[model samples]
Target: MKYSRLSIWNIVVKCCMSWVILLQACNNSNEAIEFVSESYGEAEIISIDPKKDIDEEYSMKASLIVSSIDYFPLTLPGDMVIGEVAKMIHHNGYVYIFDRHTESIFIFTGKGEFINAIQRKGGGPEEYRDIKDFEVDRSSGNVLIYSPRSQKILHFAITGEFLGAINNKVQHTSFFPISDYKIAIYNSRLSNGHVFERTFPIQPRFIIANEAEEIEKQDLETAYREQLLMYPNSSFGFYQVGDSLRLMESINSVVYGVDLEEGRVYQRFAFDFTSANPPRLYDMEADELSTFVEDYKNKKVGGWASLHRVNETADLLHATYFYDKQVCRIFYSKNNKSQVNIGASWMNDMDNIPMPLVETTTNEGELLGYYGSDMLSMIVKHGKSKPSQRILDLEKSQRDAESIILVKFRLKDF
Candidate 1:
């Protein structure tokens, strides 16, 4: 298969230069309001410093208090094993697990009883060749699956009944339903052709489309195409909290909160990296950018950024960044103006017993995380000589189970 051998370094430099010129034009035209950051209120900046040891000053009480750990013994009828769950959605007393390996969506009750698998993969009518993404409509109880190969959105009921399909004119990577009549679509890569070629220079990263028309669009400050090409897997992060949709660029420190109803940036959360502020694409010269990229490749300076979870009620944000071959978590508290740098020791905790919930899967109101079945099996076999009653019970129950365990946590009210 032939691939585009375009040098990423050259593309980044060109995109950055183009972005600077576009910003200047927008600033002069009095149209910067559409792109400029609006204030909800200044967020208390929390700076997490890198350290070899867990600094006592930064270490405070664990932000999340584990409420309960539940295990769902998946009771699939046949030889179907729950493959690696790529995405999970806990909605309306049911857990929706999207398994990418099998290209199937499996539904289970809140208590872990197998309900049914959604329509199978096929090329027939109402069937999908591939499911790029999916969203559950709580109001209508419909599961909307986006198939890139077919370029259509397949709608189905919770019970696996096919409803219909919506023709997707715009090849969006993912979508979120804002209302019954509207959706917010995200496109990370620029399409090829004359229309897209002409508009590619100023195309927005996201679009708000109704049943009939596109109502609004917003462009990002960073070079979207360059970043998408550089870090294909970890380019953008999207989280929905209540009525607000949060968007964050993996290479940037700011998290923008957009109003779901209006589809505009309403608030922003900035992280104080202090001396370690990442090199902005628009600010670095060619030589400087080359050195920066080289350093990153050699594991010398900056690392890729991933926002793992965000808790609105606790005013807390959890993220991980890799530097010098070590992955560290940034625990930031928005209300108290404090930050913690948790190293591997803290992440692994005492006796190398994995913390109850160190990674998050979804964040609706509180953070929802899980322990994989493989991790549980290892803990059961080699954890401790005298395990706690909870650990013992968890191990015993999961001895014959092939399901992942779930852990829910909420911010501790100080």
Candidate 2:
């Protein structure tokens, strides 16, 4: 006998609730505390201690070295301009960049040669009205585009062939593909009957589904209800480590390892945020929760963990967070058991040469960073120091070019 998706999900939820109750009971027991301490002996606690002065500079160990800087060719046929990049992925010797402004995916060679754009945008069949997010299925060499408006996952081959789409019922804000047939969808802004009825607190935020149907869902209702109220736009961070998928809530300190094959959470690592912990909504009354939510929106009460990514070796963890109305980048290394606050001054050896923002990790275990076309134009116009020969040559080759700058680097081991 086979169970339906809904039935399976219900069973899973009941089992999870039982586990939650058991965990809660254990939390109240001394034996549970001892067990937790022993179990998490390898876990590292990171404390955020901001300097008295915001402008205080801390020396970062130059472990990662820039290997090469290359520019994507801007001049394609029909004079297409690669607008602001929404997301970038390097796979199989091809660079896939999704331009938010144009709402199109552009394909390029690893050396930045323009190949072709995916399908054109439309409301017709095999076309997407809006692309909320996208991911490449490397195993099948297919590009999957999520269209929230159409509620579909449009599929296309890397060679620009249009495959059929999977009909999606859930209204997801973002999605990450776990396999060629499976994906994890997240919805932060949930409505119940009305827009401001305050029913979103109980809705499930994460769901796992396959191409043909939904699989299972997880909702940390007690832990996320307050977080959703405080930060309506907060979402989960999805990180891929080999075959395992890790999910981290934007405002929470815990990172959960998701078992894609089993459709359940396998393990969890809770980061210790000593002083910068956000206020919980469950602990506050209605009026107090409202006040705290307002303060949090105004950047007064709580900080948020916006993005998190771990290196391929699993030794270094890089995360971006907001605290005291300032955005901060942090590097925590498990190998060295050290944490470094990478403040506003993120530059390379070249004076005034800012390091490109790391967008994602490549298959080869190198961090891929991008310099937008606008930034490249500004650098060419008003850069104080000498530009790289590659940049100068690219500028000379294509007059009025609007190409993206690519930088690849790996975290230096201390």
* Regions more than 4 Å wrong, model 1: 1-44, 52-72, 169-173, 189-197, 212-215, 221-228, 232-235, 282-315, 345-352, 356-365, 384-386
TM-score of 1: 0.74
Best by lDDT: 2
lDDT, candidate 2, at 175: 72
- Number of clashing residue pairs, candidate 2: 0
Pairs that collide, model 1: none
For candidate 1, the per-residue lDDT at 309 reads 33
The backbone clash count of each candidate, in order, is 0, 0
TM-score for all models, in order of appearance: 0.74, 0.74
Give per-residue CA lDDT, model 2, range 249-293, as digits (tens). 554555666765655553355554444444443345666666655
- Find the 10 residues in a row with the least total lDDT in model 2: 20-29
- The Cα local distance difference test for each model comes to 0.54, 0.56
